[model samples]
Target: MSREKLLEVKNLKQYFKSGRHSVVKAVDGLTFDIYKGETFGLVGESGCGKSTTGRTIIRLYDATDGEVWFNGENVHAKKSRKELKKFNRKMQMIFQDPYASLNPRMTVKDIIAEGIDIHGLAKNDKERTERVHELLETVGLNKEHANRYPHEFSGGQRQRIGIARALAVEPEFIIADEPISALDVSIQAQVVNLLKKLQNDRGLTYLFIAHDLSMVKYISDRIGVMYFGKMVELADSDELYKNPIHPYTKSLLSAIPLPDPDYERNRKRVPYDPSMHDTSEEPEFREIKSGHWVLCTTKEFEQYKAEMENK
Candidate 1:
């Protein structure tokens, strides 16, 4: 792993036992690097384990195997309680549903101040209150709104409160797990813009998980495509859109809606034919380009290489 990388996840796997003899692979052997100040987008269909990967990395769900290196420290390795608490302050997550993530019973002030209090970020009640107000203001909410309950705010406003809570700890790394997906289409842009501004102003690193390729393209520096608990493709956002390598990636890009009605009507939808592919055996992630990587079995990898070469 490069020393410059802020987070280096290697062969990370998270699996859950289902029936007596079956297991559900949620995040299977995923590997990626997140730089200090870059937004890395993880995109996939629902239940593809994109969110699982984010949750596992933050230690909300312990990994079944592999390592997560944060600032040269292996975070997945068992740590003392103090170490764990310190680590928590450095990393935070913004959940998918803002309304569900916040406490309906707690006032916005208490919600934002929760992390600050836990991390001992403030010395006194006044300091904590000031910090809470500052975070609210940072995410474009007024200080006076701190006394209001989450149920009192609109969806967008509730999401802003969630963002404020995430920012309260002044984290260096954030996992924005589909932060705008639950909002109105019109509100999506506003939330996305707020996240972008926060990243720019705070120099924060992000693992942005979403299903919207268009929004991922807008906010991400690099994007990783996940399918069935594995990352099939990863590349620079523009490069991936322009020159998608994996068949799955190509299909996904083809599905992005075009602005022109004529073009939209002419474009074909990517057929979802699971029978055409086999994921019975897990694939190892390997680099196909300098910075791009994919997970494919040895036989499948050779076949894909041959096909790309022929093209």
Candidate 2:
């Protein structure tokens, strides 16, 4: 991963009106940067605002506050129709559900070619067909399947079609919102491997969001952990796994089941207690190490520093 920042999210907030008087904060005060050519994994349990963060960054939802910068340009600012179209072509998203994301009525070829048509990437009908075929093959599908509908394919295959559709626009950055969670366990690894290969071949950058910590560590160069709509920790993948400073992070790490039978039998689960921290002052995101950050109050920050020194 280079130092060049491909995407930056600064104090982003998204709130929704729940009933008559309540407001639900789906994503609140998220700040991070994704370097060029790196996979930045955002992981947390369900309802942690992981998926909402991705959607807000991509402008699927209008941010309630703060800014999003993509390649040094503000993404949320009002732009002309042509500029928005250009922005759309550069940033594409692969949604979580393979079944609901695609149109059951459209054939595979037309589905993938929709972007190509909108962007006017191909000059003629022949060029469009050839481009669609190439994209289908790029995503592990053949031209023969192009004529088939979404109902004819399985979950994993439909996901590949979704991937093909995203690539049809030749996007620079992709927000993969739990792309593999809907597939079977056996098929999940296959999709991940394909994504890895595509990143290597196409020099793509990703914002990979999911709840599975082990799978995230496999593909992420750096990671950010969220809880209750706020980031609790951020660090390099290996460092975060080896030395988790936050209580919530430790609890999350402890919950990951290993493959070893003996280790699994002896493993201890750490239940996170939210009340363990001091509540006199609100916690802020502070750097505990050069690359490791944790949401902690001033007193906890010093204690964490001492804990690291003792380690």
Clashes of each: 0, 0
* Model 1 per-residue lDDT tens digits across residues 1-311: 12369999999999999989999999988888999889999999999999999999999999999999998889988579999998998999999998899989899999999988888889999998888888888988899998989999999999999888888888999999999999999999999999999888989999999999999999999999999898889988997887676778878888898789999989987765555654767567767667767667777777767766776
The stretch of ten residues in a row with the least summed lDDT in candidate 2 is 78-87
Using TM-score as the measure, the top candidate is 2
User: Candidate 2's residue-wise lDDT over 61-100, tens digit each?
Assistant: 9999999999999999957888789899999999999999
Q: What is the TM-score of each candidate against the true structure?
A: 0.93, 0.99
- Which candidate achieves the best lDDT against the true structure? 2
Name the lDDT of candidate 2: 0.95
Which regions of candidate 1 are displaced past 4 Å?
Answer: 1-3, 272-283, 297-311
